[model samples]
Target chain A: MKGAVERVLRPEEIPQACDDLMKAGARLQMTYAWFPEPGQSVEVAYLAVTAPHEPFLFLRCSLPADSPHLQSLAPQIPLLGWYEREIQELCGVIFDGHPEPRPLVLHEGAHPSMPPLDPRYQPDEMMPFTSEPWDRPPVEGDDVQTLPFGPVRADVLESAQIFFYYIGEAILHCHPRLFFKHRGMEKRFEGTSPSLGVVLAERISGVDSIAHSLAYCQAIEAACGCEIPERARYLRTVLAELERLYNHLHYFGHLCHTTTLKVGEAQGKLLAEQSKQINGMLTGNRFLRGILKPGGLRRDLDLSTLPEMLNRLQPEITTYLRSMEETNSHLDRLITTGHLPLQTAYDQGATGPVKRASGIGRDLRGDHPYAAYDRLTMNIPVRTEGDAHARVQIRMEEIHESLSLIARAAKDIPEGPVSSEISYVSGGEGLGWCEGARGSTYYCVHLDDAGLLARVKIKSPSFSNWRVFPLTVHDTNMMDYAINEASFGLTMAGCDR
Target chain B: MPVWTLYGIRRGIATTSWPKKDGAVAQPEVLGLPRYHADRCRDNCRACADVCLPGALSFESCQTGERLALDYGKCIGCQLCTEACPNDALTKSNDWAFGVRNRDDLIWAEALKSPPAEEVTRKIQKYFGRSLHIRHVDAGSCNGCESELQALNNPYYNLHRLGIFFTPSPRFADLLLVTGPVTYAMQGPLRETYNAMPEPRWVMAMGTCAVSGGASGGGYSCGHGVEEFLPVDIYVPGCPPNPAAMIHALLLLLNRASQHVQGGQVAH
Candidate 1:
């Protein structure tokens, strides 16, 4: 919020502006559409970062509500394809000259009169689902057959359909039809008070509970020009790191399962459960929910017992990781599986661990430095392998980093007020970002006339990573598909939301 | 010996003897579903209902004027109501095991009595008392429910130890454990999974979402729980019910454990 610069541009100037930004080495972070005034005009904003630790640049273009049209930027910028497709489907904004423009969140049979995101739109009785084929790249060979995986996959996985063109073990092409879990999350945030909005944000992705709520709360805090107390900032950092620990451990366990290391998987999961138990002890909830509010924390946390608990769990995690590293079978499966090249990851706009693993050292914790992150010493883990092994190693290193961060935060936390009273500023817009367990989570909030939320656009890390994930899956074997996916630690809820 | 096996052996047994040994819990610090004390409610006090995001608590207009309708099935266990309550009507408790065979039992009502043990329970006990194969379908959960479901097979919970296993195929499954708010896209797949199951298969709604469409239920994409789409036999309601609660629900369906909750009240 402090360093973000905004510019209002003409609809015709978007393509040039995007080209200039791309030439300037700016990476597109988020693209979203909102109604400035009800039934009047549609405003589309593109947010990007030019350099590490630089202020975010926002380019806003307005289109008439009746005929909202914009020249497509997706052709030049591959990462903007999904964002453009989403805006096209949800806000009814047509991007002229877009390639392969298909419905992203909405499945084939869902036919709403106006876009479902439009305020005047009325939802039908039942949301229809049909197996209608979209434009998928043809893989035509007598041996190459198209196999449809699921909306209901095996085990306790999220609902998503994936199409794989394969010949024996070789994967020819990969297409993921996600968003089966789309709960209209952005629409649910409409007209809600900031406090209630936090509750909704926490549910957007249950795994990234702290990150989503933190970003949303930061956005509202920024809009209100509210600064939290020192203690609250440190505690926020602590909670986020705790979330990272559990998530990474869980991811490690799942990755092990995919590699067929049953014992390793069990051990990793048991450690994760212990980490969650520690979280439950710190906060009353296991998922670290119900504590984050707009101003700061809902309640003051007790850190007297945190250091000892974290210290005890830290050694177990070290041993677990060391053991995992030592497992040749596990290491062999991950070493070169799901190889995503550096150029592909960069071009596709990968974020969080995915980008970090691809040698991009752009961690929001160090670059942006929100919530006591600036106060602490930040050491980012980066790998250039751009494979499953690199991703796993990144998470492993991050777990250690998170533990150290929490320890340092707990030790140096200053005693003060945890929260500050927020005065809602009508028509205030703010953008907030945080480095989540998976990736950098962004939230841009616009307040309505009455100082309530008008439109909340969430750029979940998974939304970016999911877009970039299929790139790694292509040309990969069928045997390592699940392993590759597990190593990435992608969640459908985050993507769908 | 393999390093993993040795490492596991060194850690010793971490599994809790819950439902097997009395007073044993998975996590002691974690708070469960909010307990509603109807007698302590003040007249015209809708503090709990106002903050209830999922409409778990609401004032229902009954014959005797408006009465507070409390449904644990829709509760995500956020405990906002307990904090907002001026009087101690809604209190926080460790009532994590809220699994019930009867759907109506989750809705709170004064003097609501539990019906006698059904003949169906005995039949289920006869069929799946020893070993139960479960096929889980994630309707449209936030992966919170999936996280907990995955925890059931972990070293601590060890669901397979209790003879309850998550089978990959529905053909061999004795129970279809469904989670999430039953999103529209998932209804077809869910029905197909249920239909594919063998005869005498039971449906257990695993979380608040599956029970009564947690927070995202009745939204544009998803319906209110699995009950709307399928005949649910057991309703376990937590935001994402802890691993222990899921085990209790499975055991309850098999008539291995007695129902602890009746009319949303935890029996001592």
Candidate 2:
């Protein structure tokens, strides 16, 4: 409870404050900029907090409307490099000292030419950008060999350009260039209604629809000071847990499938299918869409269906676990592959299963405790080995934890209205964070008088975790890429959006 | 090995004689448009219209000079409307066979017409007798569709038991499952996939993004629709259509009763 630390600081003092905070043993959580209007100017805020603690210290900085430029913090905090580049690309704010300042989320010709966050920018003036002359400087030494994997590759479904440089069997350097599936989601939300913004958020990532929607809805509700019913919170938790259960199962299955482990693949598929069935039964849609509203849930869970779900899940999950246990060869392959050391994970700010596997017991559900998570008795699984096998083990254990959470939530659900009526007032800004299946998904929304969304900035788990992906694949082969990617369960759509 | 074979044999025949009959097993909730009950309506809400991703819902009140119209083609079946409807006027139906021959027929302007009570029993009995063979193509999808498509093979769903087996080579396929909005690059491959399939093969367009380019279609690289490049038999609308809905669509295509699948057949 450091009251003085909670106060926001001015722009010029941010770098020093960040350094002091880092020296004080505070983790450099994240940094982002908020623009009141595009091209008018921007106020940048850097968030720093110690691990296993709440009440983050926020340092604020402002830039002139005409010249949206700020001093780069990358030299001080190494993690700020990617965040700075993203801020520059999205908000048109120049981190003057940034090493690389290319577009992170927008394609070559898709935008209004100048920068996306500028309010003066019009849709008609937008042009597409191409990636023609991105050829890097040639290497001299014999040991340094450059390998270009994609823009087009076998495993990659979306478009991305990655260049991997290797020195003998070890990867010396790797650079990722993305923005292939940029749909201008943030720009599209500018003039739309608030309700429509919810849809936009859900579509940010097709797979993590509920998580994105929940984060967006929470932000909206907070901005409007709306209180959701008890049932809605319970429902939200159920949907989130279901998503986690399915995602982890699917990820495990993908890992197995990538390794060509037949029995493990089959077992993973069966578990994932069971999760899907539960999802379909609860909501008419398998992905659990339409259930989350700004103020509450769309509908109440049908009581009769609960018993059926229990009956189906209990026996099925048990059998699935047994089958997975029988497949030891698959487990052996994943054991020490794609290792990320504990120190590296901490330095890179890795979250979700990646962090937990590295023995950092930081789960937003347990640590932050939002929605119905506080009431539920949950176990946060951690493994000392930060390898693919540890990640697999964490996922498997979490599935059981999710089952328990779901069972408990279903059993203890209170009787109440599924939703509460919500209306908007003027000049409100609110932040909401939800522990998505992957990691902490944060949403900040500023609303106008009409209760419509004015501006929104979303930071998905993938944005934070993508920083560590290439780092972990330092010595791994190209063939192990899918296994490495699947183990992390990072969504390019979420990051790109 | 012999014991495993014996176990396989003891499990009996898992294949369903779909289309000839109906599927023996059904997903608990099949995909379709929502049903509205005007009688139970308190018309103060436009939440459904607001939450609809594709501008599918429109409402008008006569007394208050407003009217509500729903465009089935635009609906992704996200069901946010069902959550917002306080009057219990909207409910999700399991009847996924919503495809139509005419564009006008695809619209669900009025409340759903219920089948006769006696026919429900007959339909259930018939469902157990149908069998279907399917072929799936990865037509520039984000692989979300492919993931869900594979899940249909899992033990819980076990689409194979419903006579739904995905054929690798299209020559033996009864239906062609296309997933994605047909990207410019994949346009050739999509046509190749369709052309490779045998005669009397039906094309089932899965996902809203694929059906009418839900979001990705408007891009320069994306094709207008799967039908623009290939002859589609049935349209299963969703961003990435749920596996249950996918199964239902396959079943409907197998029924050979859908006019949408029957009409608009170009000789490949």
Candidate 3:
């Protein structure tokens, strides 16, 4: 509200405005929807982060129902390519002249003929995994051959198909087929009471449960016009930073693991285990689920062991990551592999550590500043290399910053009621966001008149960052694939959902 | 290089001595399955079942009266049923040691009896008694289960210490440990993986999602669980069962331990 200027434009005006806005230094966070009645019309929203000036530009427009289309922004905003395709598949809205309009979320034959968002759509009794809607983009070289990996992979947690058209050790072209983990998460959110939908939001991504729930709660809080207690915000800052600390430690460790660094992987797991255990001490669940409601978190800070756990966390991370940094054999594997240029990072809408490591001095925590970020110094470590090494370095730097932030917030959390009072009526729409470990995670909440969630569009940071995966693999040899993939730290579930 | 190696060595072994030592991972208020006391349920009570999102708790018409049915497989340990139960019929407990031999051990309030222990085929015990290799399939989990699964390898849990390891290849694996609600798209791959495992292979449902579809059960593009498609040897219940809980489940599978909490013990 402080710096953002909202505009309601017609379909015809969007291209001109978006074109001008991009030129004026506004970067697209995500383009999402709150469309209830599909055939009549649809309202598409563009959330742009206009840095060094107004924090955001909330541009929205309603396209006519008959055509159910708008001029494609895919060409201008290359990041919009997947976002547009997702809307087409998930919401059934076609963007006229979109570049790659083939379905994004669903495997081609995973669903029935009807679009998922259609009111009358019924799932087939037998959803056989038949054939893909489209083929992997063909690599046109005599020596190049296609080798497809996954939907199921070795030693990996989530599911996504990576088609590498390569020649021996040189990766020529890579195409990623995701949504093997899509459970129609947005579709699942519909019809559930907004109050109860927090469970759905919490499970959207396991590791980022707190941030996801906060984003959902904030949107509902915005609808209710409720201001949470100061104590609650500080508590949120503590847990969210804790989430970031463990995830980074896990990522850094896994990056080491790709090089067959046994001790590195074990240390990473050890630090991550500490984070999860501490989370269990603070909240009931290890994953920090069920900690938030629309008004505030369901529980308060467990201060009995807070000081002790924080003390343990800081040194473990410092000792482990610092030692790993000094290990040259490890550095030899990471430094030059998977280098991403700043231009490609911007053009593909790469986000989080991947973008930050490429010397893009932009972070939602420092730019838009949500939760308790404004009260913090918010030091974001930046690097120009944009390689596997930079990603690890950036994460290590943030872990140190996060540890201190948790300590400061724990000390400063005021004595006050954590929950708030809010009337839960419907016919409301609002945006909720957090600077999750991966990047800026956004949730667009729209509640219908009956207090039912009409639509909840979650744009996970992984959704944008996953776009850069294929591009990054081209930088390093094929042997570094595992290291490169883990370095990215993108979640298949979050991206697919 | 020597510095990191020395740091690791000086750090000493971080492994937990669980099964050897008394519980090391349990914390106060850490959630597991709800302990049900049928005697405490009020007459005509269906409150707990109503708030049960995954249909984990439900009532059925019986000649005696409406009877409560608790399916541990469907339960995500949300504790909503425990909170909603007016008579304290369902109470909170940290007794997460819920790895059982039979699928029927997961369902309760049906004549209030545990599944016969004989349901675990003797062949499985003979084949995997001392050592076991597991091939994990993420049928359709939220990645929460995977997080815990990864932790099993870390120094703290050190699953390998117990003679259990996660094999990347199914051909070499003896047990197929599956997580998630078993989405439709993954059904084919899941069946293929199970089929590839050599004979005497066992299926272990790792989380409530794979156990009984958890919260996202009965949705479009999802099967309620792996049990529907394949015979499961064990059921471990949690939103994503913790590392300790999962270890207990695996041990129980190999007959290394016994089930501790009895079904339907009415509180005094």
Candidate 4:
């Protein structure tokens, strides 16, 4: 409700209502869940003011599914284009005047009228829609040239499909279509208990396992009305910061690797390894799984291990940072490689490093204090360059900040039971948001009478960041694609889930 | 100009003569899977089995107490079961070389080889003599293995000094390190990778998913396990197998290869 305004409207008034909203300088952010019964269907649309510091508005409309149609919000809010397309694809609701009605989340062969997120939707029973085989469109022009890079690239990392079009030296167009390793995680979550749901969330992204799990746990905890112990809160914050550190370090190493700076890559790897070691010391698993339960933390941080953890990490971090400085080529290669204008970052609603690089000071850890974050001092790093170098510097600065926060948390370690006892409550909806390594991860949980998870909607940070990639890669050569991608560190698993 | 080389030399012999010298596990955190004590088993309790992601633990209950059977063949070294056990019955061990020739030989907990310290030390010393070259082929992994694999070269793990190195060309490789369940998309690439390797080259399926298609195998496009597509000499299981276990598997392969090269019957 911070920047959100409220409004109520009838089903027939949606088209003109949206028009009025547009005239009032408001744009559709996204449409939330649609409640559909035997004959009637009601949908909620959220609209926000386009300008900074403007309020958001929510409009509700009830219509019949047989002839369900709404006025398109694309002309007013360009960002809503993808969201609207997704709604039409999944909900089987038509946007009468929309530009494109193609599916966003589903594959080419998915059923056109199949309700994707609806409780009745069954993967095995229903026939999936099939389309003509998709082949990359060829470039047509004397100057224009098409350059296809991967499904297989030199990175020796993750797999992705990318095609870049160049008009001489400058890039004309770039399209990145993923789903090389889509595991159908969302479908798998059906019929799964909340306890098992935590595992799925953690596995969504290996690097951001703790963050995703924490978000899912928060949702369940909120629904159950579970008040986590203060010690558990501190431990959660510590783990989240540790996850952030390692992820940033890994990204830094990747950036160096792409830039062909061997020494810098080596130093970055050392830092990342140290962070992983620290994670393992804190929790038995290096990825920090099972440390978080629905109510609170699963295990208490052993005070005896603190000294050893600090002794192993602190000196190595300092030495690695110094060694990183010795390699000037790493910084040089990343300086102006992939630049996104400040406006583009804001327009795309970019979060984490992408936003920070563009000098947009938005960090959920500082803005919305959750857990032990309220007790700690938060520093938001910003750079106007908005290039690969700026992103790396922002990460490096954050890594230093995180180390300090970890030190502080460890020093002021509280004494208490790590978890609080809680019972189940039925018929409640709870929203939980956490600042994951990538950005803000939001989880919405709806519980049944038995306190089991009836429905869970997870919006990972990658969902928000993926849009910015195409925009940033605009006009840049194909070779610089890896550098830009490495800087962003987008996780396909998290997005697909 | 020579400063880098001088620094490299200054950090001399960072590589451990692992199997020979009982190479110190730089990070004890990632040693291996937790060992369960059967004496502490409770009546009708399958907590460990229930929590296990890899389906490694199986519980059979009588009137008095339940007998839990752990199959290392299925275990991913997740250690979730260890944490879930209410009693202090489960604990992790430092035994890294759990590789074997046969499917039954790979079962760690059942066989539970706890060799004497001196013997382990001698084995380590003997294994550290020859460098084992590895060729890594990612059969549609989530990049978790790639990240962890990259970490092996860091100063802390420094796998290069352990007589373990990742070869660029498959022809020179003694081991074909495969990560992830063989996906339909990567099937051709993976098969090509195996064919490119030398005749005596062993295949180490690294991770539970790679060994048995982890979690992603139940769906379409996933090709179950590497063994279905190609012969697997060893299976180092984990969600993404820890770098230590990966190194251990490589060393074990080198030992087997060395025996094979010496005109001796390589033990399965």
* Predicted structure with the largest TM-score when compared to the true one: 1
Q: Is the docking of candidate 2 incorrect, acceptable, medium or high quality?
A: incorrect
lDDT tens per residue, model 3, A218-281: 8888776888889888888888888998898788767777888888888888888878888887
Predicted complex 2: DockQ: 0.19
Ranking by TM-score: 1, 3, 4, 2
Native-interface RMSD of candidate 1: 1.9
Candidate 4, residues A102-135, lDDT tens digits: the string is: 5455555555345655556553343333444444
Model 2 residue B124 distance off true place after TM-score fit, in angstroms: 31
DockQ of 3: 0.56
Flag the better candidate by DockQ, 2 or 4.
4
Which fraction of the native contacts appears in each prediction? 0.71, 0.19, 0.48, 0.22
Model 3: which residue pairs collide?
A40-A65
Question: Tens digits of per-residue lDDT for model 4 on B144-196?
Answer: 77778888887667876666787777777767788777655556557776787
Q: What residue pairs are clashing in model 1?
A: A352-A439
Residue A15, model 1, lDDT: 89
Rank candidates by DockQ, best first: 1, 3, 4, 2
Q: lDDT score, residue A164, model 3? A: 85
- iRMS of each prediction in angstroms? 1.9, 5.2, 2.2, 4.0
Docking class of 3: medium
